[model samples]
Target: MQKAQRLLDLAALLLRAAEPVSWREIQEQFPEDYGGSEEAAIRKFERDKAELLELGIPVRWLQGDEDLPAGYLIDKDDFYLPDLKLPPEDLALLYLSGSAALAGGDFPYARDLAHALEKLSFAARGPGASEAAGQAARTLSAGDGPGRGEVPSMLEELSRAIAAQKRVHLVYAGAERSETTERDVDPYGLYQAGGAWFLCGHCHLRGAVRTFHLARIRSLEVNRAQPRSRDFQVPPDFSVADLATREAWEYAVHPPERARVRLDGPVSAEDRASFGPRAELREEPGGATVELTVTNGEALLRHVLALGDRAELLAPVRLRRRAGTILSELARRVR
Candidate 1:
């Protein structure tokens, strides 16, 4: 059976079951989808359950009634949504937002967003919900440009490895490196920012925690030599976002030093928020100055450059000079 059909069947079976259905029953009902050894069936079920959860279907494994063994079922009360009473405009906005994000194609979880939107559309029984959703989707479709290329398959493989806590071996092509090299990595987490995906993990080769751009990974393979259960573990308090911000130089970096940048004029709340918590904002009648610490000078430089004439590097006269030289080179090229 096709995977999509199997998923629908599994959901239907779970939703209709009055008591927890045993694993055996599930296997029997979808023999073509889950047939094989018990272990294979279990793995299949696990993947199906994950897909169901991603679709907003609450598939739960719990203790069964007297004769039934513990298995899976959907709690209809919780699985279904109450009437939202959302006006047509609001529903249209939700549809448009989802459609835009779907078109943007940079979100790490973009693949699941469509499924989520479908569930939301079904739940929205408020007046004019159907018409609102249809209009929103139509408006978005009409405005969208050519669709983005599909995300690399490696991203999906890495996601599974992260979920399974499996160690991976990668041939990485770092920007500064002369040649690609192999390393074993225990992925702590994944992040998406600035339209790129990054994997944060402990690298066996570097003997340090590092963030790797997904595009820079030339190849990836699971390290089967290491027992899955015995693989490296991520610290409970470890934060992917904090690591990303620091590594990306969006926040304080190693051997941090203060950076002061002058905003062109009338700095907005967004301008202040861009520097993260480590920044201090000084407001003036004309504009504003922001002081923040950074570890990666190059990343900071790139960020300031991207802001165009709206911002300028003030402190660290050396960086300011470097920025000036870059701007001059750019001007010459454009001419």
Candidate 2:
């Protein structure tokens, strides 16, 4: 439950209590197993009390009462939880931050993400979580990311397309180029990127695969969806982590390889900035093998080539040839 909602429960407890409760009386309500410092308990009371008030709970201090400087209570009617009207920026920030966490492989933290996503998704679905989500969309422009408008807007369309089982012709632009492709997509789900938004869906054109980086889509159109002969789904082994890319580069690499390379001295902090966190590194017997999930004959090879003797491509015959060709070209240039 959200802190806001949980505070509602606590306020209800106080309102139903027979008498005005002192801070100590409130602290004793928790089970003995909920052990913590006296100060911590008091601080929790203080914070939750304020939050409850913000929720329109009429929790307040009892004034002019001897030995009850911090006594608190609420009338049953005055203690009701108030509706919240969150601005769009807050909603966007909340969702983006949550989605990014799940995208980073922190599954344990997904519930919090799920909860926030639920609030927004539910608000968009019907009247359960709050009217804030609906009001939020109209209130704020861009919250955290300069590109946040893409998510709330695209998500509305994406969800509709999913339910109708329709195809959305998307205009996508990236390092590849700008072009529109009509994708009969079964929008399986949407997940967070590094503070960005992505939609995972099976593309009819690809036959069987998931795609992402919905924000980069410059244009989108909905069309009547063709029915699937078989039930379509993302592979069980597939995960958001596997599809993570800042630039929307989902193109398959040439092939997998075990490339060994030696780092000269310590790796520069500046160089570390280039290889993303997903790029794992293992120290080999002699040097190190930066375990990379890269395609064969990609720019990574050129990177290894640029490293000179400092790096050696030690796996995949395809990378070997590409390295050899690059080195041979470098030799000719040296002449």
Tens digit per residue, CA lDDT, model 1, 58-127: 7888986687779888989867865567787787677677767655545444444555565577667544
List the candidate 1 regions with Cα displacement exceeding 4 Å: 1-74, 79-97, 125-150, 223-232, 247-254, 268-274, 296-312, 317-335
**Global CA lDDT of candidate 2, please?**
0.58
The residue-by-residue lDDT of candidate 2 on 1-335, one tens digit each, is 45655576677677787667776666666534223887776676676776666445667777635755556778765654333456666655655655554444322223333544545563433232243343333333323345445555676577656544555676665537666555556666666655666767776777775566766777777765453322344457866565665322214555544454455546665454445575667665655566565654466676676677767776566777878887789789998
Give the C-alpha miss distance for residue 328 in model 1, angstroms. 7.7
lDDT of candidate model 1 versus the reference: 0.75
Q: Which stretches of candidate 2 lie over 4 Å from their true place?
A: 1-179, 190-198, 212-216, 222-238, 245-255, 268-287, 291-295, 303-311, 316-321, 327-335
Worst 10 residues of 1 by lDDT: 143-152
Look at candidate 2 and tell me the lDDT of residue 128: 28
